[model samples]
Target chain A: MDKVLRDKKAICVFVLPAFLFFFAMVIIPIFMSGYYSLLDWNGMSKGIFVGLRNYIDLFTSYNNEFAKSLGNSLILAGLSVFIQLPISLTLALILARGIKGEKFYRTVYFIPVIISTVVIGQLWSKVYHYEYGIVNMFLRNFGLENLVRDWLGDKGTALICVFIVIVWQYIGYHMLLMYSSAKSIPEDLYEAAKIDGASELTTAFKITIPLMKPILNVCVTYAIVGSLKTFDLIWVLTGGGPLKSTEVPSTLMYNTIFFKNQFGYGSAMALFIVIECLVLTVVVQKIFKSESYL
Target chain B: MKRISKKLLCLFAALSLTLSIGGCKTTDGTDGGTTSPDGGSKDKPTLKIWHITASDAEGNRTILLNAIKEAEEKFNVKIEETGTENEQYKTKIKSAMAGNSGPDIFFTWAAGFSQPFVDGGKVLNLDPYIGAVKDKLLTGITDNFTYDGKVYGVPYQMQVGPLFCNTELFEKYNVKIPETYEELLTAVKVFKENGVTPLICGAKDVWPAMWYYDVLALRTAGSQLCNDALAGKASFESQEFIDAAKKLVELTEAGAFGPNTMSVSWDNANVDFAQGKGAMLFNGNWVTGNVNAESSAVKGKIVARKFPLIEGGKGTATEYFGGAGDGYMINSATKDPKLAADVLFFLCEKLAFDMYEQNTGLPGWNVSVDESKINPLTKEISDMTKDSTGWTLWWDVFLEGAAADTHKNLVVQLMAGEITPEKFGQEMQKLNAK
Candidate 1:
């Protein structure tokens, strides 16, 4: 059986299909996008060969809303990792231990994860509404009407409101990941800690967190990458409106190709997103490696 | 180890199987619903149409469908009707055309938006059909449908942007719906003093905010200037356009637009206007259906009037703001081009006017225009048609390609009061010059 498995033909047969699939689905589209990125194509027109103008304009043009959108994407990524993870980690630590109705609490927390982003976006849009929103209504009922403002429309507050929605929708997902990671640490480590007369906090800080570093790295990497491609919620909620204060790279690419009819520029913007997301992933990996070693 | 490898192999195979089958299933489903005319001698020929009509619009899809049904019976063919939302529909149409899989007949606006399609040879010239139905359409309504001296599509509707006012609110405040710029400002001030919002225009969507600027721009530059600018003959930074921008800025700073106009969305602004929260809304006649839809205090009190004239401006009060509403164009890629054109003419000529009239849409086609056939708002608009000295296209519709997007973003900034009017004009000029 081992001799048969070692056969070259068998190896080729096993790998060929996936290689073909990867080439067709991933490699081809990337190359096509690269090809399309050089032309002044209006999506339907005979594309004019504009060369690097699209990319040059993307980076240098002051009013390229696409660039602003990319900046928003980076901001979203920063908020997700720097802000969301710490809160999710703390919540996971509390929930991971033997607690009342652990299954029920887990189910309740994970429910939001199952809800589609479209539904969440629509629900939150209604909630963030200026005049008739439940949030404003609640504020009025509590006589805190002065505090109520157009949450999604104001340029100062739009991005922050979107960030809050992202955090609310995803904290449970991150918490679940972290909790399972914490649960996987050897029970014997805790028993050994108790024998050493170590306090629970000390045991947790030294043992559990250290052991969960690999999984935490994975979670943070996901958060960063996921934030870079954040589109649906933002599109459905604000549509990068009220002076496009909440524009992000993905939405920018979408609007460029879809609304503005600038496929070439949009493709150039897309390539920038890919490169930025890659750079972010590498930077995060290096930080995680250093943290784990220490 | 052997068992684990076998399980992994099975999992990979199952995943591939599911994906391949899923892809096949989707294609099959799509084909079953939208089989094209080239399905062979044994198959029934099918024609597809893309539209953006709402389902609730009275007699809209039904009228089009009935027309298609009649055409199918006459031509012995099958027809499929699909409707999508505004922006999505345009995106889908563009992508489909790019991929050479566009529907046989698709809806398109009749301006710069259609230029690329016409230039690309993606849309069929409809001059033949236009000539056939020349007597049936309103005079010169077909002119906007012409590109490069060739008619590309039949115009379905002519929308005139008018000031829709709450008559009851005007009566309550003892202020007339202003006919001149100064009177308009005074009326706004009166409304404000009486604790009523004057004009409820939202800049959130950008287009609604543009209406105020369009009227002001028309008043400042007049039709010749606008026509030249739109034709790419004049600079966007001309004194007229700049002065118009400044006037709009002045209006904003003077509280002409009520509190939080920047925050109020298109829907909310319209709803507020319909509810009498504001005295007037400067919008196209297309809004009559929506205004009538609202179960608010000012339901029947809404009345349409021409835009007020500006002080010391060339534009007459009779000059209007509007364009040919979205029209139907045949995809050049369709195999049965004649059938596609037939379907388009059937929809636009036989069905569109009737459906539009019922839904309170102001069709450009020469339909029976008895006052009894239209809503009060539409009748008022129709009456003003004789008074119209000229028409200015919406700024968003005139700026082509990236310049259009740039121009719109500037408008958004202007609406937000982030950029001064001069800055807005300068930025727009830079974009237009590019």
Candidate 2:
């Protein structure tokens, strides 16, 4: 049995099918998008090769709005790392410690992760509705009428409101990932730390956190990449509107391709996103690895 | 045991490979069957029709479904229909047509919206079919669907922008119906003083807000200038365009719209107007049906009127911002283009009468109206449009592709107070330059 398991032919046979599926689904479409990015096509006609002109226009033209969208994505990614992840990590740490109703709390925290994003978006949009939204109604009932503002209407607050909804929807997902990893740590380590007079916080920081570095790296990567590609929630809630104040790259690409019929330009935007995600993922891995070595 | 397991693994791999190959072959066979000329087993050809009316859109959906049923009976062809929401329908039709497998007949907006399809040779030119049905269609209604003097679609209905006033609110505030721009401003001031929102605009959708800009542009700049600007002959930076923008800005500064206008959706805005929370709504005549619906709070309390004339402008109130924009077109790649065209014409003719009877819209086809059936507000709008000296299509419909998007986004920004009139003009000109 061991000899059969170690056979290279078996390994090749098993891997080939998956590799073929991946090639057809992912690799081919990416190359096709890259090829289309250099052309001026409207998805219905013969494409004219323009050679990086679409890329140049995306960065240089004032009307393109691609740069603004990229900036918005970066802001979302930064917020996810600095704000969302920490909240998720803190909850995970608390839940990991044996507490009352730990199972109930874990289930409650993970509920948002399983809910459809579109349903979440619709729910949040109602919560942010101007006239009868619960958020404003609550404020008004508390005699804080002065604090009431159009949550999704005003450009000043639209992006922030959308960001809060996004953070709320996914904090559960990251928390579950961290909690399971925290649960896997040996109990003897904590027992020894307790015998040495180390506090709960100290043991958590010195032992549990170091052991969870690999999973932490994975969660950070997911958070950042997920932020860069967010569309459905933003599309449903704001549609990159209130004067395009919440325009992100994915929605911009969709509008360019579908609404404006600028397939070539949209393809360029898409390729840019693919490259940006790839580069950021690599940089994140390097940073984590360097820290581990230190 | 090892040998048996190895054999099973090889068998599984070979079985999966054969199954995948078989699946691909079957898909190709089905594709050919559908596209082949004589693939249908039945004698009648199947005709697919696509449209953009939500099932709950009340009268509009009923009219479309009834027409489809009538056409199937009259044309002796099996008819299949699919309906999608408006924005989704646009993308769905375009993508399907791009893939060369779109419906035989589809609904689309006229002019710039249909131009790309015509230019791509995906739309069948309906000029040959028009000769037989020209007498039934309204005069000049077909012009919007014509490119290079070739008609490519059938106009189904006419839509014109009208100011719908809540008469109860007007009486409550003791403000008369405005007849001129200055009087409208006075009315706005009076309404504001009484703590009432003068205009209930759904700027969140962006298109609803564009209606104000469209009317103002039509009145201030006149139809000729607006047409020239849209056609790239005149600059959007022209003085007339700036003046129109300034007029809209002036209305905004006077607290004309609700404070939360930018957040309110079109449905919510309609509700607010119906509930007597707003004094006026500037939208298409189609809103009359909604206001006159069984559940509407503003039934019998609304009055329709032309937008007030801009003081000292070259244009008059008779110049309207609307026309026969929505209609049906036949696909050029259909198995029987002539049959599709026949079905389209018959369906459109039937649809026009149904739309008028249902009070869904103004009929693009000239038909004897049962005047007693229509709501008084719609009757007033129809009478007003009969005297219209000129008409201009909506700016978003008249401009194609990126320019149309720019116009919509810029108008939203203009309403949001994020950009000045000059910036709006400059940005519009930039779109033309592109």
Candidate 3:
């Protein structure tokens, strides 16, 4: 086995396909985007390479909606990791233990994960409807009409409303992952704690929570990366409007490339997105490493 | 076993990487040579036409399908309709053109919207083809299709913006059709006092709110100023333009629009007006078809009139807000340019007039269609265009880049009372600055 491990030729044969694939897909696109980022192309015209102008404009130009969108994406990712993880982890714990109709509840929670983001966005938009929606109707009936303003229309509430929708849709997915990880911890650990005269809460705190740390690190990384790439739900819900207040990086990149025909600039924004995602994933993974969790 | 698992992981990663690279490959090739030449299929001479219409989807796809059917029967060629949502359709057409594999004929707007493609020489010059049947289309609309001494597109319909009024609510408030800006204000005041919201506005989409602002600009500063602004000879921050913005803010402060105007969707606003919840809506001829489909309350009660002129402004009542909607263009790369032109002629000349007869469209083509067949409201909009001093195009239709989105959103902010008129003008000036 040690001789086989030291065999470099075998390693080359095994790794060459993946190396080629990585270069073809991720590495080549990055270089291509960097090249295109210098051009004065509008996705239609013959491109003219002007050298680093798109990047210059993206960073320094006023009314840089792309930069604003990047900021919004970071805010969304931050919120997803901070708020969504803890709540999902708690729900996952409660449901992981012996409970009535656990299978039924699991299915119900998993249903949102199965549904398409477009349908979820559209459904939530109806519920957030200012005038005739069920939420507003109920609010008015209870004389809490002052609190029933346009949730998706107001700049103050638009991003938060979208975040709430994202949480509602993905909480089940995270919960299932955590629940499975929590379940793998031996039940005898809890029995041992009980034999020590520990309460149920104490047993859970000492045994189940500590055991699910590695998987929770993965969950946090997934949540951060996934939230940064959010596009469809935000696009369908707002198209980043009432005044482009709720625009995230993906939608802004989409509008830049597709709507405005600024393909070169859009490519720069996309490259930034890739870099941001990579940097954020590393930071998150490092911050919540398995060693720290242990 | 461990070696096999590692190999499987590499295989999966390789597959994903290949897909990622392949996905962006088509975008890199711009020579329009992606589609392999058909050695055998050339006998059939299939003309691929792209349109943003599907009946099952939203938009006027049903009308486009019937038109396509007529074209197919007349030309003996199979026509495929690739219908998509509005935003998706724009992106698809833009990418298709970029890839050089665009459809033979596609939907386009008349002005600056088509300028990039026209300037790029991606679109075919349809001047001679259109010149053959010059007398068959309406004068202003035919002229609109021409850009820089060459005609590249044909208008399918002429849409004129008019004040769509609720006759029942107007009668309830004892309001007559206002002739001047002052008279309109008086009418609005009367409606407000009578507990009727003067307008059912949906500003969230930004385009609908643009109708109000653009029309106001035309009345306040005249078409000359608008043209100058579009040409970059004049600024949107001028006193006259600022005055127009100020007037719109005044309308909002006076409560001329319904409660929660910012939150209402265009569909909901239309429904509210149809149900007599508001006194009026400022929209184009196309809305007549939408309002007609609503429930009984607004079945026959809606009527349209020319937007009232500002009392002391430069624009006359004859000046209207309008555009040549969805100009049809032929691809220069089409195998059979003549055949593609024939299909467009069919849409512009023959099918268009009949489309009007079916209450499906307002024909921009001059083909003899009796206005008597159209609904009275639509007829008024069609007739007003003939005598109009000038038609104010939508801002997005005229401006390019972030300027279009920025200006439209600024108007929305103005209407929502988020920004003052002066700020609107200044913001636009800032956008227009080098």
Candidate 4:
């Protein structure tokens, strides 16, 4: 085994395919986008080299609306961490305690994660639709007509409405992550805690939670990054509108690059997204490390 | 032994990655071009065509499918047809062309939508074979498809803006028919007070909202001025353009449209209109056929009318909106450009007559189909276009991508009351300044 580990041929064979795949999908695209960011291309005609103009315009341009979009993404990230993660953690805790119909509940909760994003988006859109939607139908049936407004169409509520769907779709995924981690702690630890007269709450707080730290950190990082990179659900739900209420960086980048044909400007946005995601990811990891003793 | 198993697993994972990628490549490479030199599949040479008729099965979709079937039988070719939904098809074709992997013949809208492909040198110059169907086309109808003195696409259908109304409700509610801005305002007031949705504008599909603003702008600024503004020969900051925005805002404020116009897609709006939820829908002439569709509750009862004349406006009832149609363009990289061009023009000619017979659209080509047998609503639509003073293309189609989206966004913002009419005009003027 030591001989095989030391062998250059084995190392190359093991690493080359992964390195190539990563290079092809990620590294090369980033470099190319970085290059494109410096140009004034319309994704069609000849691209003029315009140093830093797209990047400058991205921050400053009113139509680009980058700051607002970034703020929305940050809000989504905050919600994912504070709201989604807690609900998921609570569910994970309950499920990990081994309730009746535990397997059925787990499978049902995980169903949305496997379904296509488009399908989920469309389904949620109908649920939040102005008329004939079940929510409004219920509101009308209860004589709460005044409370029934176009949920996905109004600026004040569009982002929150979209966030609810995202929360619903991802709860099971994060729950499973924490659940498995909690479940993996040996049964002997619980027995030991019980012998020491530790209640379920005490065991959860002092034993299980501390034991689940690494996975919790992993879950938090995934949640933050995933929220930051979210585009499809919002795109399918709103296409970033009514009044640009649900606009996020990824959706804006897509519209700019594909719809507007402003490849260079959009690439500038693409590069910014990669950098933003990376910086946030790093920042999150650092925070988790610093909180290790918590 | 544990370490050795882990190492083996790693090796197997790498092997699988390589195998999967290689497998994908093998499949892609084997699925090669339209015509093969070795002639294994020459008995039924496959041609690729991308269309935007995935949802509308009753109309032009059938024409396209039948044309494909007929072409298959006649030419002994298997056509690989891809149908995408409307908004998505724009991205699909544009990205495919940008990546230089576009279909052999792809459906494309006229003017600004096709400009990128034409500018990218992705579309085959159809000048060589256009003469075959030259006489069949209406005079200068091909102008929209022409770029730099070369024809790149061919149109089969055309539409003009017309105000379609559920007049039965208007009569039931004792509302006066609107022929002027004042009357329209009164009608809106009556309808809104009576709990009926005065207008159904699908602002979620933002381009549909632009139809109202475009026609309003066309009325205020006139077709020539609208054309000039679009051509960047004039500015949008003019009062006429501002008035168009103001008038649209006025309608929204008057509660003319449903409260949730921003949430409804065009298809949704169409459904609402058919269900008699809306009193009026100021849309393209194509709605004439839709109004007569089997599922429509307002069938034959709805009537097409002229948009109300705006006071102090330059546009007359004769000045129209929408005189363009989606067409097919051949990809420059097509394996058989000649064959692709032949199929394109043949389909174009066949679709022209087929669309007319089905009342799908006002055909750009003079139809051989019996005129008297066409739908009455389509006849009203056809009659409306007969005395056209000038027709302005839909602003979203007239403006190239970014400008088009910006235009639609500005209109939506104005509709949502987030932006003032002055601001909308100023922003539009900024697009021209760019």
Candidate 4, residue B225: lDDT: 98
- Alpha-carbon TM-score of each model against the true structure: 0.90, 0.94, 0.89, 0.92
Model 3 over residues A1-294: C-alpha lDDT tens digits?
454456675466456666766887789989988887888788777899888888788878747777788788878887887888887888888988869988898889989999998899878888988767788899999999788888878888888888888877888999999989988888888888888999878867778877888888888888888888889888878878767889888888887787677888888888877888889889867776646434
- Which pairs of residues have clashing backbones in candidate 2? none
Which has the better lDDT: candidate 1, or candidate 4? 4
Model 2, range B40-110, lDDT digits (tens) per residue? 55787888888988776566887788888888888888887888988889898888877677778889998
B-chain TM-score for every candidate = 0.89, 0.93, 0.86, 0.91
lDDT of each: 0.78, 0.86, 0.78, 0.86
**Can you give the DockQ of every candidate in the order shown?**
0.40, 0.54, 0.37, 0.50
Local error of candidate 2 at residue A208 (angstroms): 1.4
The digit string of per-residue lDDT tens for model 4 on B119-177 reads 87888998888887798887778878888888998888887878888988999999877
Ranking by TM-score: 2, 4, 1, 3
lDDT minimum window of 10 residues, candidate 4 chain B: B31-40
Off by over 4 Å in 1: A1-8, A11-19, A64-66, A133-148, B1-35, B38-44, B54-59, B193-195, B294-297
Total clashing residue pairs per candidate?
1, 0, 2, 0
Who wins the TM-score comparison?
Answer: 2
Per-residue CA lDDT of model 2 for A1-294, tens digit only, reads 676558887767667766776887799989999999999988887789999999999999755589999999899999999999989888999999989999999999999889998898888888988678999999999999998998898899999899898988889999999999999999999999999999988988998888889889999999999999999899988889888889999999999998888899999999999999999999999999889531
Query: Where does model 3 exceed 4 Å of error?
Result: A1-31, B1-42, B56-63, B66-76, B187-197, B294-296, B430-434
Model 4 docking category: medium
Predicted chain A of model 1: TM-score relative to the true chain A? 0.94
